[model samples]
Target: MNNFIKNLLLSNFNKLLQSTKIACPKENLHNSNRLKFYNPGKVTYDGKLNCGITSYLTSFMLSYHNIDHKVWLSKYGFGDYLEDHVHITTNSGLLIDTTYRQFFIDYRSDGNCDYYKYLFETCEPIFVGSPNEFDLLKKSIERQNIKVFGSLNQDIKELSDFWKQDINITPKMNLYDMRKSNEIHPTLLVEIPSLIQPLIT
Candidate 1:
């Protein structure tokens, strides 16, 4: 079955490459041509999990959508933007962050939620990953129209729930992340990026 899928992907890769659109920082794009792949590091709004699945997924989705963005990793190495929430452009682009709690619950104070509120009201943010986070995001938004994307597969029960709802979930597969490590080639484990080709095309 895997071989069949691989063959199908290989056969249609050209079409996917052509149809797909990716936007990246101009500097990154120029560098991308020279490097074998992109290796975006993990980051968050606070000095918490310097790395996370959400951080990596953000870069992956950007690559998937063909969009380039620079995450403001403050010089102090903490994305305190959640606390110091500021106005930002939304229509042209957005910022993304992922967390386990539903609706910024771990935030030490109302400031964090306020920041998210600002983000929702101003530059619409597109958040994805973790079902708990999604539930919180909706409730906090107040405005029923705010939209965020999320998913998780931590246990069989969750998977069963997802299946029961007939939600659009992708089958998991290993691909590659261009991030370099000491022993491994920069490429790390990744979901099947090529899978989107069929959905998009």
Candidate 2:
């Protein structure tokens, strides 16, 4: 990594470490109020908090700051179970993981969780080079390749639709289908664009 990028990552890392508050609840996973706690407003008020919430907040911050990046998910197999971890990728495909500190915190607080232990030992602040360099650290990581605002627009719409369904009823759309769906409300199309201002020539 170049000195500039190294310094940039360190600065951002320190800022996030000092400013962001941890919000992932310690108990009652199923009965917890997810929307109330994990929404953008709450996250902004409390910090990124967890993997999924952190990824969304980081992505939004990157866009607002005019940083060229994409959010990527890394899936790991722990015996019969698979878990997804989210991080960010620069325009050059470099990896940036701002919330890695949480893993260390969780591991130190409770060593019983094997996943956090593995992550705390393995994860680094930034991957420090190309996507291939980052890939060398983790096996079976999936990059969403969402390099532009347009890519996120559809996924956001599908997510909105999925959430609109009845609480007891499951949506007909599968996870993959919802993520890749293209149809969106025209009125909501301006949301991302407004956050990311156009570059001046």
Candidate 3:
């Protein structure tokens, strides 16, 4: 991709990350702990956040911006068990994961999670192209004698349907109607326009 588009995507992504509140529920502490394999940092646990939320928020932002992207879920095998992580792939085949930083933060501070550390430090936005290409990259990593986590499995679920459903339920028309009827608080209504403008327009 050209630098201009790359910068635009990066800027919008950072803004979305700052604006959106992506968090898991502290009430589901047990479930949250189970997903910690994908979240390797103190901020994630303390903030009650997980990789799923990050993927959702990223998808939402991309949708709002009218960016052509698909959410990819990959299941990884851990001996007899499996775990999943979701991330986005652009129409042009670029991979983007705003949450990979969590792993880096943990690895930098604790000097553990070497695989995740290497991944975040090396890959730009993570893997590019299809899952097969991703598999090749993983194999390359393993060939280096690196103990890569999660052998990729066949179960992959695309999240475009979920995004469509969410958009349908939370239509911008309702927000506009609420604002027009004075049903929404003035301050919130004011804030809503800036955020929803892209989706509506």
Candidate 4:
């Protein structure tokens, strides 16, 4: 992707991100223990909470704009066994994750989480910039010998279908409708249902 197109995609992305209703629950924000995660001066919401919803909105934006991309589903690093996270890898060579702060705030700080270090390369609010960077993150996961599903390639429609079932959202829902809904917490959506998995032999 040329600089012009990349810049344009980035511009659109920032606009959508700013317009989207991403937020932290008021109660959580008030909790002394969880207070640090919600920075009132910058964004009142929690990044960890918006991870999934923001990803799909981002992917669809790319598709509609004629930008080629692949949505990647990964183990959320913090969830019930059925959980997985979503992100985008654009053909233009950009790796996107709008809610990366969530990873650090949600898991990295917990020293009691013995497996936390193994789950992610850095929970320090950094993003994977390119496919090569993404691969490094994957390598880190492998080096730790984690058994989680690192990431699976998926189509937009498949993810949309999952959302429809998980949150009464429609597959054909447009970006405008999605943005109008303000915020749809990922916690309310289940990525892959256990029933959808085939039994092992």
Candidate 5:
């Protein structure tokens, strides 16, 4: 993409991100202690659940903006499992989904999650492409008729119809390491715009 377009996308993304509402429950002592992983015989002290709120929000924003993103979903690392970050190439300005992180609350039905709301609030401008997961979340959030701010993808109606009968959805993932690889070579700044055509108007 050209410099002008890239700058415009960045500007819009920042504006949207600032307006999104991504809130999390405070980490309390009890919840903190429950974060340890356990095995049948030897329960190792694994650690806290990573916070993917930021990473997921970034990806969601990129997707909403119609920008091309490459996400990296990695295995659990130090600290919380959800604590992931977004990476944008300095030159090409492409987005990547380095990881897929989601959270579930037992008290709520499928998709009605704080995690999704947090992401929606954080990743501004880009409307959520009603992935089945997102529809389920929307249903869950409607108890109070809360207004959703951004746009919904054109496919939302179909996804809602297809997923309406399927209430039992589970969140699972294969964690990959998201750390930047050794600097084998310098980051490239290609002018190729095909990969990101979806994001640009």
Candidate 6:
């Protein structure tokens, strides 16, 4: 990646981390408590969780720049827990993780959380790692490379069709802190981002 472009990606991702809130519930229709990490931008509010959603947002930005990237799923997160760990590697030779602090810098409970009443943002959520961190992660944890994409489009129709359930999303404060303010990402208001990684698409 060009220095300028890498800097730009970092700057924008940090802005999103400090400015946006994710609507990821403890329990969704699919998994145990994950909001389909690919598209946790809905409502229910979480920060330290959903690295995949963070990756999607970052990958979305990369895609907007016409940068190709690949998504990967880590069976376990940085900490020793079965957290929803998913992130991306860009063709620019950068490993970007906007939601990394959730495990490394913040507190993660073994089970259950009260996100509605709690503010999970303790420190800055931006983390751009070199090959070292990526190498360490590879040796320690188990993960799989899913798919690479030139761009990812929101598929709300597909999710709605498959779920066929009423989404009772409660509002919350800044999770990623993109600071469109009052709620979440400005883009998320209009375009629903795709989930982190569903079993199928």
Work out the TM-score per prediction. Answer: 0.26, 0.38, 0.42, 0.43, 0.25, 0.42
Tens digit of per-residue lDDT, candidate 1, span 166-201: 221121211113322223322332223332333245
In model 3, the runs with Cα more than 4 Å from the true position are 1-5, 12-14, 19-49, 78-80, 101-201
lDDT of 6 by residue, 105-191 (tens): 112222123321121232223545555764554322211111111222122111112111122111221222332235424444422
Identify the candidate with maximal lDDT: 4
Q: How accurate is candidate 1 locally (lDDT)?
A: 0.29
Give the per-residue lDDT of model 5 (tens digit) for 16-69.
232222122242211221233222111111112322333333444444444454
Which consecutive 10 residues in model 2 have the weakest lDDT in total? 161-170
Task: Please list the residue runs of candidate 2 whose C-alpha ends up more than 4 Å from where it truly belongs after superposition.
Answer: 1-5, 22-49, 78-80, 99-124, 135-201
Better of 1 and 2 by TM-score: 2
Q: Rank the candidates by lDDT, best first.
A: 4, 3, 6, 2, 5, 1
In model 3, the Cα lDDT at residue 145 comes to 23
**Which lDDT tens digits does candidate 3 get at residues 1-201?**
424435654545434433333122233311133245545322232222244544555565555445666666655556676455556677775665444433323222233355444543354432234445655554554432234434322221112221111222223213334423424334333354454434333
Q: What digit string (tens of lDDT, one per residue) describes model 2 on residues 163-196?
A: 1112211121111222223544132232322222
The weakest ten consecutive residues by lDDT in model 6 span: 156-165
Each prediction's Cα lDDT score?
Answer: 0.29, 0.37, 0.41, 0.42, 0.30, 0.39
Error of 2 at 146 (Å): 37
Error of 4 at 177 (Å): 11
What C-alpha RMSD separates each model from the true structure? 18.4, 15.5, 9.2, 13.1, 18.4, 16.1
- lDDT for 31 in candidate 4 is 17
Q: Compute the lDDT for candidate 5.
A: 0.30
Position 14, candidate 1: lDDT: 37
Candidate 5's displacement at residue 182, Å, is 44
TM-score preference between candidates 2 and 6, better one: 6
